[model samples]
Target: MRALVTGANGLLGSNLVRELITRGHEARAMVRRTSNVEGLAGLDTSMVYGDVRNIDELTRAAEGCDVIFHTAAVFSYWGYTREVMMETAKGGVTNALDAAKAAGSKRVVLTSSTAVFGGSDGPKVLDEHAALVEVGVPDYFASKAIQERVALEHAAKVGVELVVANPSLFVGSYDYRPSASLATITGYLGDPLKITYPGGVNIIHAGDVAIGHILLAERGEPNEHYVIAAENVTWREVHDTISELCGVPKPRIKVTRTPALAAASLMELAAKITRKAPLATRALAEQTGRYFWYSNAKIARLGFLPRSMRQTLTQTIAWLLVSPHLTNKQRAKLRPHDDVLQAMRQAQVAQRLKSVRIQDLS
Candidate 1:
């Protein structure tokens, strides 16, 4: 099969490209002229330069392909206007589908996100049937919801074959540019400071996510969505794991939602002023302020099993240790100072426990 993979330079895209090549399929990678090609090095595939939002460019790139994997998107919670985010996501998906139909592609796999489920409370495990509540969700999540709707609606109208894979936080080796998951982990590594949050996240390995895309293209039902996730863990557990991997002390600070929200808002303001990406944004804080767990039962039923979080983290950390872009000093600087604060908080709690014991004896 001749396959066209959009965003072939990204984390999941690179992995998917490699998988397709290994499986003896003809893979044509669609990348922007300015995209990082370091990930594509040594991979056997043809390349086409174009942006997904450009319909003419995409149509040209889609020529003669049997399948299309639409994996490109602007993934961020801050630093973009709602118009830019939504239009790009929805436009990209629409263009890809149109191009696929014109090129006589058999299937077009759209890479969506588990964020479509939005923020939730408690330990609820969301499946594909979970409805979206757009009231206070982040722009990125909202954009993905729109993207999925557009893809499915277009597929129905055009009689095009389409499938959507909604993956959670992706982690694993070959995270060359570091995703949001890696950024959060690296931040904690720099400070060893305990950061407190109210929510949890389900994580999947990027390689597994790439494989899920293949499976969906081969066997998924048209217009259906599948979640690709492995484990649901809290912020505390996530931070502690990074600290352990980096040999840093864990954070003792247990910050609540109020302070975190305030910090994120202030950061967003500063980012706007500096014309730089915010360390955290109001949208991200709102997301972190609630539990965002999901279940991959649908995909698992299709023989998609992901590696354990321990396995994923271990390999990811090992790769980071030797990464040319991050020197030892540079890596040390990435740890969050919050770890020491968390430790201090733990000490205070221990002291209070001792005091209570003495008072009871009196």
Candidate 2:
């Protein structure tokens, strides 16, 4: 199959492109002029330049592609105005569908976040059936909800098949932006003392998410939403895993919800004063102690398979070792953990070999 992937330089998009090529499919990677394509290095895919907001440009880029994967968005908690973020979200969908129709693409697979499933303070599992709550969700999430709605409506109106893949927090390679989760890990690496909070979230490898997107295109029902996730882990568990992987001390301080929110607010205030992005954001803090757990059974019906959290984190850390997003100070801090990182990489290789042997035996 030939496909066009927007935001092709991003974490999910880059991995999706790699997965497409690995599966012997052709991919046209549509990225902006200024996008960093380091993650796409050595990938055997055609590169096209276009913005998702421009229908004419996107149409030209989508030509000859059987499937159009819309994965472009302003993925940040700060540094973007609400208007720009919302426009990129909702407008991107409208343009992508239009472009799909204009280019005669068969289907458009949109990448939405699991944040659309309003999180709970407790461990309430969410699925695609959950309703999106707009009362107090972050702008990023609200925008995604709007994007999903627009895609569903527009696809039906324009006569284009649409499938949505809502993935949980990603933890795999090709993450050039490094994602917010990876940024947090980098912060922990920079500081010896790790701090934890009472929050939980679903984590999935970006590679598995890429597979989910492809499955959605191939076997997913039209207008269906699929949750692609691997593990639901608490913040403490997340930090502990990283600590073990890096051979560093585990989180020693557990900040409760209220104080954590306060800290996030202060950090945001300081960021504004310093004209920089904060490590933590109030939007994330507002979901403190909430369990963003999800069930991927819907996608499983389509033969979707996701890696374990350990496997995801292992690959992520291995990538982080060479990621250019890391600061010099952060790299220096991580240098001492080189032995631990190498050991983890070797163990991952052995585990994969064992899994392959088991599969062959079966």
- The stretch of ten residues in a row with the least summed lDDT in candidate 1 is 353-362
**Residue by residue across 1-362, what tens digits does model 1's lDDT show?**
78899988888887898789888887888888877766666666788888998888898888899899999988876657899988999899989988988888988999999988875778778889988555577888888988888889988887789999999988654556555667766666554455656678786778889889988988899889999888888877776776665566777787767787898888878887898777777767766557778988899888998887755665566555555546767665444234433443543343343211101100
Give me candidate 1's TM-score against the actual structure. Answer: 0.88
Best by lDDT: 2
Report, for every candidate in turn, its global Cα lDDT versus the true structure. 0.77, 0.83
TM-scores of all candidate predictions against the true structure: 0.88, 0.91
Tens digits of lDDT, candidate 2, 1-362: 99999998898998899899899998888888888776777666678877888888899998899999999998888889889988899899999999999989999999998988888878889999999765597888888888898889999999999999999988677677667767767777665558877868888888899999999989989998999998888878888888887767889988777887898899999998999888878887777788899999999988988988777777778767665666676665543356447744763453343111001100
In model 2, which regions exceed 4 Å deviation? Answer: 327-362
Clashes of each: 21, 0
Question: Which portions of model 1 miss their true places by more than 4 Å?
Answer: 332-362
Q: For candidate 1, what is the lDDT? A: 0.77
